[model samples]
Target chain A: MDVTLLSTGIANVASVSAALARLGVRAAPSVDPETCRTADAVVLPGVGSFAAGMAALNRHGLGTALKARIEEGRPTLAICLGLQLLSESSDESAGTPGLGVLPVQTVRLDGAPRLPHFGWNRIESAATEGLVQGGSAYFAHTYCLRPSGRLEEAGWRVATSVEGAPFVAAVERGAVVAAQFHPELSSTYGRDLITRWLERARAQSAVDTTQGATPCR
Target chain B: MSMTRIIPCLDVRDGRVVKGIKFQGLRDAGDPVERAAAYESQGADELCLLDVSATPEGRGSALETVAKVRAVLGIPLTVGGGVRTLQDAERLLCAGADKVAVNTAALARPGLLTEIRDQLGAQCTIVAIDAARTAADPSRFEVVVRGGRDRTGKDAIEWAKEAVEAGAGEILATSWDRDGTGEGYDLALLEALSQAAPVPIIASGGAKTPEHMAAALRAGASAVLAASIFHDAETTVAAVKSDLVRLGFDMRLVSAPMLPSVSENSPLPS
Candidate 1:
């Protein structure tokens, strides 16, 4: 299946591309809107600041394409900062607007022992199927998506957690999916999560074809 | 965090894995890619590649080695040595290194740390401090650079704090006095650094047995890094991880399913 790995110019895009290749899936790292909008699946992987990531997407004119994919219920996965960009706004890079796919705001993990919550943490998956439940995933970020009051209304679910503080680990609202941790770096559990997401994307594409809908290129 | 990490540090000189006693008497260990794959299969949580001879010529060879290793390895890879400028760090990152470690350069110009952090993000920046106990003042330690060849007269603990404030996400503190001595890690140094720095501290130097690793973890290190023991096959990553787990220290055990053999060629469940 064709997978478009969106380049925000802030993350380790090579690692994600390598991981996809190892999974026997074809992926292209691109900033072009057409490559992202027409792919069977799209992944927005990021590592740097929210402002820098958003600026790149805007510069490449990928913001509108990403919105179109989400609105059409196409399969997409965002990792780490990519996950943060899906929110409506972030306290980090103050005044930077996110993609607004998920109705939530990302904030710093204040009062924690450390600033950037580096290292692996167990993710208690809320979804029963197609998600690695109760497995640890690598996380390296200071800002996180806190439990939003509009979570239920927006059809958002907390896919995992570290302590009692719930962050949006993985959200499955229609075809949009995101993980706050680096699945590319999370060893086996990470590989499995990516594989499951790809399988779902492939299945979704097949269903679209059967419905006689012309897939966007 | 899930568990304490067991990182196998590969000292590469001229693109080959090498081992030495406290940065002296260098000996070839093995090929970088072969040894890296072996470590991954043996359950190493992560791998670190230090180009002991990071000359302009050696830098090209190191990047080639990094690409080869990255091709087969599924875990995180951190590359260090002679990373002087932002471009150097960018080159290594582009070559497939998950993180770039800066030492002498960071010590020479502290602002380089901020520049790398701002450009590459602090998560990708690691500050490796080679520190030796002070001769005149036994209670303190001094930061050494140039592969532990020169002493900077700077306090190790104080430098660690400064590096963190300057945007280093992690500190690889190598105890020069204990490195390759096989006595054990400098627990007192690790304890002090851990308390002083807010970021994760990776304790390096002087690892002989799994118990030594356990002691280092208990001493407040977020992770334990070893070279000689793992390179020489004196111990395996699994043994050390088992020891740490047995001691009740949280560790990510390399399960059978986590092995690299479970690649794309492997069958997937429907």
Candidate 2:
């Protein structure tokens, strides 16, 4: 599969790319808008400030391409800050706008003893089968989109976790999956999650090829 | 809130696993990559690789070691030792370390922590403080550096606050008085540091048992990091995690069915 991982210029990208390599996939990291827009599978992995991440994407013109890909229902997996970038806006940087693909506000996580909820935490999802299956995952973030039933009302499968407050862990709609947790860092559960997402991405790409090319499955 | 993190700290000297003075001569025990994979399999939430052999001039082997371990380690890995400059921290992060710890160097010149934050956010800057009980004041803990060989007059609590002001995200608090004494963690020290530092405090040294770890957590530690208990074959990360669970501490259980074992030749996650 032609997987283009949108690199937001963070340093710890090795683990994410290595995990992809283990699954018999070489996810080439790229900031080129065309490559990001046209890839069979696009992974948006990010860390650091939301403003910086969105700035980098906008600077490279990949943000618009990314929103276009998601608008077209392409297979794209967004992780951590990447997930936040798909929201409408964020409290971390109020002036900086998100892709608004998910129609949610990325607010500061409240009710937590610590600001940045680091370490491993349990994620509970009711979906029988999807990108997340209610497993323990690694999380490191100070801001998150609070669960207000708005995402579910919009017909998206949402996973929720508590770190002093209930928040949206992941949301999947069609082939567009975004995770607030770092599935790439969750060890076996993490590996299994990526494998499952890739399988879905691969199947989606094959279907696209079939539809685009006359019943050639 | 979040679950208590169980971290197994690997002491590396010149890129080899150094299990303190008493070497645990297991088969290929000196290899950092092997031990890291084993710990992840055993359910460690995170791994801290401290290069004990790193001098003022950082060794390139440390970076190589971090890169190799990160290739197999799925969880977060924090690297320390010989990180005297902001460049060293950047190089280590590029080599795949999720967080960089500064001890002696940060103590000498406090600006390095701020520089790391300015370049690469405070989320990656960790200040490791080695504190010992002073005869001058048992209630107070003094900062020790150079692997606890040199004692600086700075107070541990005061330094932690200062480091946090200079952009430190977390404090790796090690009790020099109880490092290897097997008594337990200095709950008083944990309490003091937790009071002083607003950020997450990772308790290190003197973790004799799971009960000791629980005590440290109850005393306000966000995570518990141990070395001899894990490296000496007395206990495994899995055992400690289970014990913590049984003792009523909320912890994320680990079971890696897809991760390949160190001895396995398989490249794919089954």
Each candidate's number of clashing pairs is 1, 0
DockQ of 1: 0.52
Model 2, stretches more than 4 Å misplaced?
A213-217, B21-29, B55-58, B255-270
Candidate 2, residues B1-270: lDDT per residue as tens digits? 588999988887666666542222212235788888888888888999987764643477788898899888889999988888988898888788888999888988999999997666677889999999887989989998766777888899999999999989899999988876678999999999888877899999888899999999999999999987776677878888889999999887765433454453223212
Enumerate the candidates' DockQ scores in order.
0.52, 0.52
RMSD of 1: 5.0
Candidate 2 lDDT, tens digit per residue, A23-43?
Answer: 779979898998888788898
**Native interface contacts retained, candidate 2:** 0.50
What DockQ class does candidate 2 belong to? Answer: medium
Error of 2 at A113 (Å): 1.2
Predicted candidate 1 versus true structure: per-residue lDDT over B114-205, tens digit per residue: 98888878889899999999989978999987667888899999999999988899999999888888999999899899899988888999
Docking model 1 quality class: medium
